[model samples]
Target: MTESTHAPLLTVRGLTRRVGTRHLFDIAELVFRRATAVALTGVNGAGKSTLLRMIAGLEPAPGATVTWTEADGTPRTTPLTPLPQALRRQVAYMHQHPYLFRTSVRDNIAYGLRARGLPHDEINRRVGAALGWAGIVHVQDTAPDKLSGGEIQRVALARAKVLEPELLLLDEPTSSLDGHAREQVIALISELAAEGRCVVMVCHDRELINLPGVVRWKLGEGQLDTKHR
Candidate 1:
C-alpha cells in the first residue's frame, strides 16, 4: 500500500466511559494515523489509563468502534459484547507494572507465541531478538520478580514486541523508571513507531508533548483535544 492508502491504524467513534458519577473519556471521534506514534496526555485522573484500556479492548466502553488493519490489508472492527479472538491477538497492551510469569524472562516472552502454536525454535529466536531490542539481554534467564522496576517493564515490552501486534497500547510505561531508564523506554517506543507499528501511550510528562513525529491528544473535562505538532 502507498502512503495515501495508509488509513488510520486505529479509529474510535463516539467513545464514552463512566465509573459511577465519574466520566473518564467522552471522545466523539479519534483516529490514530498509520505508522505514527500518538501520546495521550492529561492530568493524573484525566482518563488516560481508562482510554488506553478501552482501545485495547480490556474493558467495556460505551458507543465506540475500535478497528485495526493488518499489513496484509485485512481490517476488523470491534464487535458488540464479545470481541473476536483474532482481533484480541492483534492488539497488545502493556500495563504500568510488568507482570512476569513465575518462570524465567525468556518464558514470559515466549508465552504468547506458545499459545499461538509457534514452534519452540521460532519462539526462542523471537524472544531472543525481542530481549535484545529491549536492551535486557543480560537477564534473559533470570526471574522477573527479582529484577528492578525498569527491567521488569522492559521485559513486559519485550514480550509484547515479540508478538508483533498491529497496535500497541501502553499505560505509563516509564512511570517507575529513573532518568536513564525513562530515556531508554522512550527511545524503545520511538524505534517501535519507526518500524510502522501504531503506538498509543498514556503519559503525563511534558517531554512527550514535543516528541518528534508524535501526535499529541489531551483529555480534559470529559473531552479530547488534539495538539498536533
Candidate 2:
C-alpha cells in the first residue's frame, strides 16, 4: 500500500472468500479512495476478478465490511444496507468481453439511463455524450457483434459510463484491443477518474497502468499486495 495511508472512500476489512479447498482471499484489507484510479495486475487465475466481484457484491465475502462514509462524516465498518439492489446501481462492473444485448449500440447505452427513469431526450443526450467520449460515435447504430473489437469495448465502456456510477469495476478492458484502441480506452479511464469517479481496473500491462497518478495493486499468492506508486 502507499505510505500516505489516507482515509479510504471504500474500505474492505477482514475479507475472506473460499471456494472448495482453495481459499481465494484470506481476511484481505484494502481501501479505495474516491476519484482515484487503481490498477490491479496479476497472472491468470490470480483472484483479481474474484476480488472485484466480492467488492461489487456479486459473490459473498465473509468477515468483511464494505463501508461508505456516513452523512455525518464518521467512519463505519458496516455491511451495506438494503444490500444487492442498491449496490447494483452504485457499482458498475464491466467484464473482459463486453456483453451486448444483440441490439443496436444506441439501445445498449440507452438501456442504463432508461432503467433510471430518465426521459427519452435525456437518455439520447447522455448516450450521445457517452458514445462520443468512448469514440464510438460512428458505430452508434451498428449491431454490437458486427462492430470491431475496439468498437465493442467502447460500447461496453459507454454503457457503464452513461450510468454515472460511483464506482466502476473493470476486467481487462483493453486486453482484446489493438495498441491504439488500448490507448484510447486508457485515456477514457483516466478522464473518468479525473471526473471524480473511483475506477478499479484489472489490467496486466505495465505501460497501461502507468497513466499519470494511478495507484497499482498486485494480486498474487492468494493476497492483494499493498498499493504501489
Candidate 3:
C-alpha cells in the first residue's frame, strides 16, 4: 500500500525513560503509521531498545501515554506503566537473539496459537502456513539446537507472524546474521511491512536503516529526531 493510504496506527505523547538521574529519551510526541516501517537508530547507550521494549509493554514508561487506533477507528489511550491487555494482544516483540522451545520447529511456531487456545485444526493450519511463509517448512521437525542462526531467526519470525500482530517490534533483527542469512531476514522484514503492519525496528545496520521507504528515527541526547515524519 502507498503512504497516502496509510493511517495512524498508534500515537505516543509525553514519553520518558530514565535511569536514576540519567535521562534516556524524552519525547513529546510520536506517531506510528500503518503499512509503514521505522528504523530506529542511535548510538550505544542511547536506549533505542528500551524505547522499543516500552512500546511492546515489556518495560515501564510511567510518563508515557499510548493511544492505539483500532480497525474500526476507535481510539484507546492508556498509560505505559500498565498497558492494557487489549493493546498487548495487538503488539509483538522479537528479540535480537530469539529464544526457541526445546520442541520441533513446527511446535515452536505453534506455541503462541496454543497459548491463545486456538482450535486444534486452526492452529495446525496457521503453523503450516507460517512455516511455509518463513521458508522453514523443510525443518518442521528439526530441533532448535540443530538450526543455524538464520534459521532460528526465521522460526522466531514465523512464531510472531502466526499471531498476525498489528505492530511488530524488532530489536536488531539482523545483528548476528551474514550473507544469505542476512538477506533472507531482510527480505522477510520487508514483506512484513508490505502487509500493512506497523513495523518498528531498532537497528544500527545501515542496510536495514536504508531499506526502501523505511522511515528513520534517531534517538540521542534525550530526544528523538525523525526523518520523513
Candidate 4:
C-alpha cells in the first residue's frame, strides 16, 4: 500500500457496544486514514462485525462520538444516534454474503447511482467503468442467481465502488472462496487502498491479515488492541 500524507478521514471516540447487560466491546479511540487498509481480527463473537456496522451507521451506539473530517480539514462530530447523510455517502459497507438485487449485474451496479438521481449518461459511464474495474465485465448481463460466489462478490464490490466512497467497510470479503477467487478479491482491495480510499475489513484469513502494509486490530475482552504498521 502506498503511504498517504493526507489527514485521517474518520475518527471515533468512546465507542462502546453492549448486549443486554453484558458489554461486547469498548474502543477508546479509532482512527482511519486514507490509503490505509485495516484488518480487524478476534475470536468468534468478539463483535468485530458489530463494530463495522456501527461505523457504517447501520447499527446504533447511543453514546459514541463520531467525527468525520472533510478533505478541506473541516471536522464534523456528532453523536452516533443519527448519522448525517454526508457521512453516510462517504462510507460504504459490504456484508460478507452481499445481497444482490434480483436483476442483471449491470443493473445492480447502477442501483446506487440511480438512487442519487445522477444523469443517465453519468450512471452509464460509472457503471461501465466499475464493471471493468472489478473485472466482471463478462458477467455484466448475467442474473445474480446464475453467477458463482466469486462473481457475486465482485459484483457487490462494483456496486459499492461505483459510488466512489472515501471509506469502505467490508465484513469477511473473501470467506469461503476458491484460491483464484480469493486472490481476485484481495487484488481489488489493494487497488482500492492504493487509490487513497480507507478500507477496514473484519477478517481472519492470514493472507488478508498479513497483507503488505495492513494494520491489525484485535478485539477481545471488551477492549480493542490496536497496532499500526
Candidate 5:
C-alpha cells in the first residue's frame, strides 16, 4: 500500500478469498483515499470483480476485516464485514450489466432512497436532479428496459449518485458500450472523481486507464500493483 499523510477513506486488513480451488487475493493491508478514481486492470479471471465485491461487503472471506475511521475519530468494525444494510447506501457496487426494474427510469433512480424511507416529495426532488445531472431527464418516464446500453449505464450511475455514496464501486462501466457510450461513461467518471467521491472501477479500456489524474493499478497473481498516477 502507498503511504499518505492523510487518513484513508477505508482500510482492509487480513483479507483472503478463493473461488473453488483457485485462489483469488490475500491482501494484508490496502488503503483507499477519497476524491480519487481507481482503475483496476488485469487479465480475465484475475479477480478484479472479486476484489470490488469484497470491498463492497457483498462477500466476506474468512479472516477478512474492513474498517473506516469516522469523522469524529471513532472506528466502525462490526458493521465492516458483510457490511450493514445501512452502510450499503454509502458504499455501492455497480455491475457491468445493471439490472433495471420494470418501473420508469425515475422510479428506478429513486428506489434506494425509497428503501431508506425518504419522503415521497424528497424522492422526487432527488430523482429529478439526478436525471438532469445524467442528462436523461427526457427519458425519466420511460421504461428502464427499453433504453440503450449507454442510457442504461448513465441511469445506473445516476442511481449510484443519488444515494450520495462516499465510495462508488464500478465493474467494467464501458465494457459493453460503443464509442459514444464509452465517452459518456468516461465523462461521468471524471465528474464523480472531481466531486471527491471515492471511486474504484474495474476496467481495461485504454481510454479510461489513460485518463489523467486517475490511480492506475494492476491486479494479477493475487496482488495490487500501482502503475500510474
Candidate 6:
C-alpha cells in the first residue's frame, strides 16, 4: 500500500438489505472519500436508523460488499453489515437517545478504552480528554440517571469520542435536546467532520443539514442515492 492523494477511504458496491419481505435500499458504488459530515434524512419509517446500524457493522447481509482503502492505499474487503471486530472498533454508532451506564460520567466515557484492555493510567488520560472534548468535564462525577437529558447526551458524546472512531454514526443526535443543547451538539458534529472523521448523522434539522462541508442525502423509495446532493 502506498499513499495516494485521491482515493476513497471506503467503498460499498452492490449493497442490498432485506427488512422482512421488503428490500431496505438499493445502494451501489458508494464511496466515502471526504471527511465531511453526511446527513441522511427521509420521512419517518424510512429505515434511516436501520441503514446507519448496518453500516456500523451489525447484522450482515449476503452479497453486500464493503471495501475500505487504507491511508497507504491498501484495500480491505468485508461484508458491510458485519465488519470484522477490529474494523468495527474504527466505527462507532450512537443511538437517538444513547444509553448511559449506571455509573459516573467518567466511567461511562472510559468504557470503550477500558474494554480495549488499555492500562488504567492510559484510560484515565483518555477519559479526561474525552470529557474535555464534549465539554462535560464538570459533570465527570455525575451519575447517568441523575443528569438532565442534555447532559446525558453530552456524556454519551464524550464516551463515543474517547474511541476515536473514523466513522461516527449518529441517530438523531439533537432530537431530544433544547435549543442550546442542540446547538452544542451541532457544533461538535461539525468539529468532528472537520477533524477528518466521517460523520453520518440522521437528522431533520435544517440548520444541521446546511452546516459547512455537509453533504445531504435522501433515503426513501427503497434506495440510497449518493452524488445526488
The lDDT for every candidate, in the order shown, is 0.79, 0.80, 0.89, 0.89, 0.84, 0.79
What digit string (tens of lDDT, one per residue) describes model 2 on residues 1-229?
2224445667777777677988766745687777788899878887899888788877776667777665588765666322445446778899999789998999999997987899988999999999889988888889977988878888888899999887899999888887888778878888888887789999987776887778888877778886655
Write down the TM-score of every candidate: 0.89, 0.89, 0.95, 0.96, 0.93, 0.92
Q: For each candidate, C-alpha RMSD in Å?
A: 2.7, 2.6, 1.5, 1.4, 2.3, 3.2
Q: Which runs of model 2 end up more than 4 angstroms from their true locations?
A: 1-7, 70-77, 80-86
Alpha-carbon shift of residue 200 in model 5 (angstroms): 0.5
Please tell me which model should have the higher lDDT, number 4 or number 5.
4
lDDT by residue (tens digit), candidate 5, 1-229: 1223546778877877788987777778777788888898989998889888888887775676667776688987653466765467679899989999999998899999999899999998999989988989999999987899999999999999999998899999999998887898899988987887788899988888877777887888977786544
Q: Pick the winner on lDDT between candidates 2 and 5.
A: 5
> Of the pair 4 and 5, which is ahead by TM-score?
4
For model 1, how does the per-residue alpha-carbon lDDT over 118-219 read when each residue is reduced to its tens digit? 988898899989989999989988997788887888888889999998789998888788787788888888888888888888876566546777788778
Estimate the lDDT of model 2.
0.80
Colliding residue pairs in candidate 3: none
Which should have the higher TM-score, number 2 or number 6?
A: 6
Q: Best-fitting candidate, measured by lDDT?
A: 4
Better by lDDT, candidate 4 or 3: 4
- By how many angstroms RMSD does model 3 differ from the true structure? 1.5
Measure candidate 1: CA RMSD. 2.7
For candidate 4, write residues 58-149 as lDDT tens digits.
Answer: 99877888788666878889886666767878889999899999999999999999999999999999999999999999999999999999
Ranking by TM-score: 4, 3, 5, 6, 1, 2
Query: Each candidate: how many clashes?
Result: 0, 2, 0, 0, 0, 0
Model 6 quality (TM-score): 0.92
Model 5 misses residue 139 by how many Å? 0.6
Off by more than 4 A, model 5: 1-6, 227-229
